[model samples]
Target: MNYELRLYLDQLTAKSASIELNSTYARAIYIVEGSIAIKNGVSTRLTLSQNSALSIPESFSLGGGSADAIMLRWELVNEVDNSNKIQASQSTLLLAAKMALGDLSQYIIRCDRVDFPPEGEALTHRHLGGGIRCLLFGSIQIHTLGNIHTHQPLSAWFEAGPDAVYAATDKTLASAFARVMILPRGLIGGKTSIEYVNSEDKNKPKSQRYQIFIDELIQH
Candidate 1:
């Protein structure tokens, strides 16, 4: 089914301060800073620390339990759910757009981290699916669709799957970003979605690394 993919950067301050996040869409939360306490329904409390990731369906509440915390959330919404718009609760909506997912049964929602060394560059390439990405550290220069932009930490941008893209990392430091992509279910077992435009580029030494966090095939 067609859906709207959304990204939000949520912040929480002070201890015991909680925020309600009620949504019917599937969500993936990555803790960017500090720690948090999550409560599902009337009971069931869980704590997530920095760098931790959690995938949950339906609704729940997440709050900062110690010090302040930061979270990056990715959600997928159905077209028919437009009537019940998401009410942003203490979170900054980074990106939101419709996804041409004709059907989700043959799709897989994946979250992964890509890292490039200093002065590293990704040759011209395209992917099998589209999604939003957020830079975590250092910087990156992305050139695609006749547009170029350099992103800093916390900065986000959308990557079109079929469009060719070329990226370069900061000259002085390593760059990394965390992204959530909706890809074909066939690529579920750690398969890559990138396809280099020039076959010779694939034979060249690669300077980037990948860490897959979530790879769940959509359940009909």
Candidate 2:
């Protein structure tokens, strides 16, 4: 797969401190808390409140608000080709729209609300499909691919193409909650769309999958 996941967080505490975000990949910003003002130096200032999201275009420098705000930013590695050089069928467009809406249909698209108790950890495992997660509260550390990264509240992280083994543990004595969305890279209409790989000592369990309705997300 040519796509990669880039996740980062922005915290604005002081009234004079602003975050400069510039990315070559298409990106999206989700406001985890407080309010943020987004300006691209060309458009009018856009204000986003808690639980709101905004899509940003490639090659843009946007300045975010300067006071007590936490936001999760997500960007994909490859810029999607939007040229109409090759025509696509309606079915193909429908599928693409479904994928964008987080509806994988026959493929796997699961939303999991994961809670890790104090000092809790998950068995080393890998998902055939990649996913993105945002911490709702507390913090968690992820150990994967010879590296360890800790994510704090309102922070977002994601894995790339299949075979990325990782384990997660809470960073504090308090429990941590996260909302995760997992999706398969390629859709398999008839066969199972996702798989799970456990460590050698762990049992091979069936893959647990869930569906996310687009209407439900829109209402929230």
Candidate 3:
């Protein structure tokens, strides 16, 4: 698996600013702030701000305009070594929904770019199963067995030890947030599962549907 995912930040304040491309490489870009016009053979202007992105191909001629903006760039390296893993190409503009975790047949994992508005909470629950969650943005307070575990930005959680029993509190007191990636590792000698239920649903039994839910997650 490729483990070299990166985030780049570029702030542009000039007009008609551009870059050239004549080779082939796969890459993605997000307009974290401001607007820009992109040109390959023709000009395609995109006025983006806050979390918007673009994927670029290495083989095309590239140019663009920037109207006071900042962009986040995500690129996939080493195409020849991982040809089977390549699905999204460079030179394509991508929104939040377009970002994804590709191929899960060989692994048990689910990554989501979640968004929590200000003064919002993710509800109360327990990770009674096994998995890991990497927080790529914002903050969260996790509860495990009625205990408080507050994590700030770039924090992570893992379930690989005997002391993995945990849960979260329902009382939330924060603003906009997101849970970037949640993954279940291959335990050396342990069990693993992921589950979620609509708190609004009353027909399902709590914790009884975790296995089925995890299996269903891999399909997406």
Candidate number achieving the greatest TM-score relative to the actual structure: 1
Clash count of each predicted structure: 1, 0, 26
TM-scores of all predicted structures: 0.90, 0.45, 0.42
- lDDT, candidate 2, residue 35? 68
Ranking by TM-score: 1, 2, 3
Per-residue lDDT tens digits of candidate 2, residues 1-220? 3443444556554353334444533345566677677667677577777666665634443343554676565544433644211122100111111123233232333333455656666555655455577767766777778888887765556654354445455545554433333344354232333343544535543222222221111110
Candidate lDDT scores, in order, read 0.83, 0.48, 0.38
Query: Tens-digit lDDT track for model 3 on 1-220?
Result: 3233333344455474455533322344445456655665555544555544444534333233445665444433332333322223322222111123345333333222444444344333334333334343456566555467776644445433223233322235322222222234352122433333345533443321111112212222
User: Candidate 2 — which residues are off by over 4 angstroms?
Assistant: 1-4, 11-25, 38-46, 58-67, 77-115, 119-124, 130-137, 141-158, 164-168, 171-194, 198-220
lDDT of 1 at 114: 90
TM-score of 2: 0.45
State in Å the error of residue 116, model 2.
3.2
Question: On a 0 to 1 TM-score scale, where does candidate 1 land against the true structure?
Answer: 0.90
Q: Give the TM-score of candidate 3.
A: 0.42
